[model samples]
Target: MDVTGKVAVVTGAGRGIGHGIAMKLAQNGAHVVVADIVEENAREIAREVESTGKTSMACFLDVTDRQSVESMGESVINQFGQIDILVNNAGVIGAAGWEKRETASEADWDITFLVNVKGIGTVTDTISPHMKERRYGKIVNIASVAARKGTATSTPYGASKAGVINFTQSTALELAPFNINVNAVCPGLLWTDMWERIAVRFRSKDDYPDELTPREVFDRFVKARTPLGREQTPEDIGNATVFLASDAAENITGQALNICGGYMMN
Candidate 1:
């Protein structure tokens, strides 16, 4: 899996899975653009990428804000000339620990969709036309295994991911004729800030109990749900992402590849 001399723009790349993806791409020879809402994080990641002997730049991107997204998009195009690979990794699982399942507010739903769903479209719109002009591009959307099925825990999250899968398929078709491939990666359990929040929600349940710490709750879920009995890491997701963005996956598009440890298969 190589992306030598290519240009990749990764959103939410300041940390976690996004950081991993940026590093992997740079390690594989792609000049990376570390775009994140947090300018400091983006700058830090960009420096990290540069330290690996690859050229990189930092861009501030708020996926929910068109102006912010557009500004970053323009900056990347101006600096790199073109974006050969685009990874839509910016997303949110908006829910409060206090909010009950049946009582999920419209505010939560709106924010989740705005970032997880519409955000992808906005970023793609800004970047894809350039891809079409060049008739070459690779688009990867970071979805979740939750998209494969519904979860009583976070209704909006699962639904937003499901929407991501659908968007991947639809955009794949639209961009295929232009020689651009679009795919989705449905990552399994990866311990991140988002998962920490999920763990907090789990503790609120009757089964988790007060004695069970967040890590313990997360471990219990990972052991029960993952057939391989191993937690998925940012590096794992990064590997898959680099593969999809590389020429090895030129023919693959409009598909959601599951990165879970056999926890989700469809």
Candidate 2:
């Protein structure tokens, strides 16, 4: 994958999978723009991008807010002159704590979809016009294996990711006419802050093994669910995102590629 000299904007690029994507894109020769809800984190990642000899700018962004999305989009254009690639990586899994007998509340579902699904639309609405004008762009949405199948434990998150995959395809078809490739990457398992929450939640279950700590809980699930018997990394997701954004994938769109170490097939 080659994105040399391209200007790329990554939402939630401060840490975790988004951080990995920004760094990888820079390493691959793209000038990266780090956009995150956390200003300090975004700035830190932007400095790292610059340290890599790639141009960068940090923007405070809340993807759910149209104004925030518009502001970040404008800043990137003003600083980099163009946005060749956009990674829709900002998302939420909703509030974490729930007893085994309990289920996700309506409010949790609302907030989850607001950030994961509507947020994508907000940011894309801000950037797609520029892409159409140039007739060139690459859009990658960060989805998850949860989209492929639903679990009662995280119905909100899974449903939101499923929306992401569907939205990815719809946007791909629409943007293809303008030579913009839109795709989604379904990351299986990564031990980010989000995963920490997941592990903690699992450990709190009444039936869950009492001997297993949060990390152990995570490890057990990884061993059982991952056919590769290894945990997925942020870099793994980054690699897939970079490829989908590269010229080599110019002809590839409307596809949701799983980067889960064979954790979820087809």
Candidate 3:
């Protein structure tokens, strides 16, 4: 998985899984562009990557905003000459308290789709042309296990990830002719900010344990539900991503690999 000298762009890389992916790519010798909605976070991650003796640049990106995404792509191409890999990790769980479908509002649904599903399209649409012209590229989309099953508490989020899976297949088929691979990674229980919000929801339930903290609930869930008997880490997701983005996975495309601790095997 030697990605040395390759230029990679990771969205939503300020923190959490995206941050892990960016760091992993850098550690593997790829020049990483840490793009985030928060300029501070992007710069922070870029600095972290630079500290490891790897090249990096921070770019402010609003995935839902077409112009903003396009600008980031153009800037990266202008600076790096080409983008070898794209990791679409930017997404949202929607407005707090609207996780359940019955209580979910149209606004929540719209925002979730805009960021999770449509945002990937926008960024890929902006960068794929460059890859097409160069006849080489790797795209990794961050999906979720919920995408494969219906969730009572996370309907909209699940649907949005489902869209990501389908979009990955579509793009993989279309991009295959150009020698590009498109794939999706469905991660299980990682304690990201997104999961923190879910922890809040769990704490609010009457059945929630009295002595357990929000994180404890996650630990319990992992212990009881995950066959692997542990929660997945951001580094786990990052390793899978680097493999998918490397030449090692050249024959793999239109596939959704689960990094869910065997939580949702299919």
Candidate 4:
């Protein structure tokens, strides 16, 4: 999968899955723009990409803010000339402390939708026009397995990802005539701050094992539920993302590809 000279904008590229995706794209010869709300983290990741002898730039982006997203698109266009791929990886599971729907406040639901759902639309809307004019683009949205299976405790998070899947299909249909391919990547369990926070919530459950640590609980859950018997990695997600963004997956669009190691068959 060669993406030489392509320019890709990856939101939330400061850490975790987004960072991994940015690095993978850079390694594959794409000039990556690492966008994140945290300026320092974005800069650090951009530096890491540059260290690989690939071109990269850091942009301060708040995905929830439409203006900020638009600014990022404009900045990337100015710096890179054109945008060939857009990876919508910016998302949230809400704050770790509030897990259950009963305990989750209205603010929690609002923020979750704003960041995970609307944020994708915000960034894509800002950049897709460029692709449309050029008649070329690849968009990989970072959805979750939760989108397919609902969670008792994290209802809002699941709902938000579900919205991503639906949005991907709709966007793919609309963009297809222009030769833009839109797809979703559903990642399983990965050891990131998001999962670390989720582990904390699991440990609070009454049925949680007495001897197991939060991370142990996470590992155990993955081992039992996933047929692969292990946790997925950021690199795994990144590789899938790069493939989707590359010419290798040119014929694929509006599809949800799960990287959950058999946790989800669909």
**How many clashes does each candidate structure show, in the order listed?**
0, 0, 0, 0
lDDT by residue (63-97, candidate 2, tens digit) is 98898899888888888789999999998887544
Clashing pairs in 4: none
Show model 1 residue runs off by greater than 4 Å.
95-102
lDDT of 4 by residue, 76-167 (tens): 98888899999999988885457543466777788899999999998999999999999999999999999998775488899999999999
The alpha-carbon lDDT assigned to residue 63 of candidate 4 equals: 93
Evaluate model 2: give its lDDT: 0.90
Predict model 4's lDDT versus the native: 0.91
Candidate 2 lowest-lDDT run of ten: 94-103
> Worst ten-residue run, lDDT, model 3?
95-104
Residue 102 miss distance in model 2 (angstroms): 2.6
Please provide, for model 1 over 77-183, each residue's C-alpha lDDT reduced to its tens digit, 9 standing for 90 to 100: 88989999999998778845433344568878988999999999999999999999999999999999999988765888899999999999999999999999999
Error of 3 at 59 (Å): 0.5
Error of 2 at 117 (Å): 0.3
